[model samples]
Target: MLLPLRRALLLGLATVLGQIVWMRLATGQVAWVQVAILVGVTAALGTVFALNFTIGHLRAAREEVKRLGVNEERVRVARDMHDILGHSLSTMTVQLGLTRRILETSGDAALAAGRIAELEATARTALSDVRATVSGYRALSLDSELAGARMALSAGGVRVELPAATDAVRPELREVFGYVVREAVTNVLRHSDAELCTVRLGPAWVEVTDNGSAAGGAEAGNGLTGLAERLAAVSGTLEHGPVPGGGFRVAARGPTAALDPAPSKEGEPI
Candidate 1:
């Protein structure tokens, strides 16, 4: 808004000086004092005009950068919440189902009590995790996920087999690998009617194989899709499909640049 006025002022000063200089030189009567004043005023106004716009542009750029930063933060929070809630809620759903089944029949009261306690524990842990995630303090651990997977799968009456330890995994790859385990097991619990689940973990990869053909149903949910996105962020790959004859397999392999190269699954069925 104000630029044109400032520009005109600078231009007018310069033009007047130019005219005066030409007139004085042509008239053969140059006044050094007048010439100096004209030059000084023109230069000062020119400098002011340039500075005004430069300062304005700098302020505008700063504002734009700040807005972009806020937007990026918002997107990050959204993604975090989606992953956290989706995972925790899905596990809780499976626990609830297990609780219901136990309650339905005149089964062992001790078994029902145990399942109820586990369900309560799962709900409490999820609530705490949600709070932590919102505060950006939550971290995914392969060890924790493994322990939880055993419980979730067991609750669904699926036999569980997990590697004895995950010390072989690189420290940096544990979190994404944890997500892979969580999502895979959650899918098996919520969707399948598998009788057994096999978990295989290498230094740079993790796979969950199950005998559930149509366990809830054969469809990809948001949890699985989100896991794929998370895997991509760490230069990892997610592969899942029904095995040749029967069953389903969900696997994730991390980057080869990590401590150990990704495991080879050359003969694994699609």
Candidate 2:
């Protein structure tokens, strides 16, 4: 790469040469004023060349930065999709297996038919969720997640205790709380064979607790790691570990005060 000074000097030299040739042809000889004019034109060309070169580099640098930012967002979107679909697919797999077993073992047609219907319903719901994820505007609500958790746990043969409504929970915190519920319930479906699961929502916090050994395990997969990152972005906190006696628990807390009380108390991700 040519240094700015060297490039400038070359530009100035070229301009001086062209000016000299023109002056010599136009006038019989070089006048003092012509010499001064040549110097002025040379400086102007040099300065202009240097400035143009600098601007070009600056534009290239800006484009590179923009590309990097876009790439980063793509990575985040990919991670979110993996986490969402992983849990949903796992639940559907379990439901399908149950339906197949019922068909093979149950002598009663009605019982088998019921199980098949459930399986079909679960599959359709999963398909809709996948579509929402693809649209990139999925806004998981605390209410929806709680109801989903109850239905999913029941399907998995786990007893679930969930609140009817989380009206007390601040609106600003609902979405993140919903996310907490989703990942926690997903873990229960995919990894736990627990008999009981419970979800509780508070003013600024939500907790998912289960009486399953898988929750007590020390593994933190991409789902949990990503969950932690999401919480951090909202100035929230996540805690997941084994319950003191049995099973495991996951909890998240939002900001102490409204994120922006003047508006909605909810702020964009940091």
Candidate 3:
């Protein structure tokens, strides 16, 4: 390869130049001034070559790191898409199958109409979720998630309580927390038989705990895993486990700095 040849050339040049300088000095044919100038020039050229090589290597390394990071991000996005679409499609399939069964057995127009309406609603919800996922900027905030959780739980006849003094989460981190809250609430609605859910936010962390038996078939779906990855991307963490008292709990944490608000941009007059 060209690398070996280049290295060999440099070695050969160094050896020959060294011998020539040595011979010139031994024969007294070269003046001290000339020797000094020649040595200084050689040193300067070596330093330049070294710097050039170092810079080139560093640039190559930086580009490779960037490429790897981009690939990782793409993979993460693909996984998230798969999780969201796959679950939605599965639920839709079940609903459609139920509708078909109802249509085949009963010629009841009212029931058929109701099924159709449900299907339409499900489709719309799925479409909205897909849009949000694709946009990447459709991140929900913590306060919004809290409100949504309360509404959803109350609709399900589950009593809910939230903390009074929640920390002011950063915009990016708040989005991640919102996703976690949404996912937890969805899981509870779909799986748990609980009548009570509590959300607590403190200086250390935020947790959503439910007082229901763990569903037999419930597992950490791809959605939850994706949520974890998203949290980690913003230097946050997600933890989930069974609560000793009865139900399940999901929590996320970040540094105190992350909870601070951005400085105001107010200016004196104009």
Candidate 4:
């Protein structure tokens, strides 16, 4: 393309400048000294031109790196926001709807008031989490996400069967798995009509299964896409699809970093 032409033009210009210097310094006839001077001048000019090109290229490369870094940060923020706000808003909607129904059927002011208070607390916590995520200070834990998933599923009227502990999962993968749990549960709440949701944990994998009829036909949305990317960053894999007969399953498996020699069943779904 144009690169070789540019290089040729630079070299040609440098040679022409060198020839002019040689002519000005010529003593009417060429000699060995003059030839040597011409060669030296041309080499010097070529070096100068080459250095200029190199510096220009280096500057461009630096700018490209900076731009790429900014883009990466932007992507990270967008994904985190989607995960945070999406789940929070969904939860709030479900809670409000459920509260309204309870009030309509039972006419229990005290119960409705208590549920409203809990919803308020959830909103506050979600706000705090959003702030933390924006400030790059948010840290997700498997245990906390498990608890949140259980609460969210139950609130959505899905009977949850969640692991009692996270001791079997690898420490480094806990955060990623936490994200998986959050997104998976959120999917169940928002997209399914499952009555039973079960979460199973192993040394290097976590699976969320629900008896939702829509499992086979569910499309891959932004949540699942981003979750897959996040897991891939740490050599982890995400598998999500309909089960053999009549359920949806989302599973995340990380590189084996188990604490136990064999997979333990200590954190089986309760």
In terms of TM-score, the best-performing candidate is: 4
RMSD of 1: 4.7
lDDT, candidate 3, at 224? 71
lDDT per residue as tens, model 2, 1-270? 245687767876776777778778997676768668778876777678778988999999999999999987786777668666776676677777777777777766787678677767767876776677777777777787788777777778899989778988888888878878888888888888789988876677777788887653347888888888888888888777776667878877777734422211121122
Could you give candidate 1's per-residue lDDT for residues 1-270 as a string of tens digits? 244766667777677777787877898777767777877886687678679889999999999999999887676566667666666677777777776777787666788788778778878888887788778788988899999888777766789999999999878889988888887887787677789998888777888888877745245566677777888888888878777667888878888734555434442533
Candidate 3 lDDT score at position 140: 49
Error of 4 at 64 (Å): 1.4
Taking all chains together, the TM-score of candidate 4 against the true structure is: 0.84
Ten consecutive residues with minimal summed lDDT in candidate 3? Answer: 261-270
TM-score on alpha carbons, each prediction = 0.72, 0.73, 0.61, 0.84
**Candidate 1 lDDT trough over 10 residues, lowest sum:** 261-270
Candidate 1 lDDT score at position 53: 81
Q: Which stretches of candidate 3 lie over 4 Å from their true place?
A: 1-25, 28-30, 79-119, 142-173, 189-196, 200-205, 215-221, 233-235, 257-270
Clashing pairs in 3: none
Residue-pair clash count for candidate 4: 0
Candidate with maximal lDDT? 4
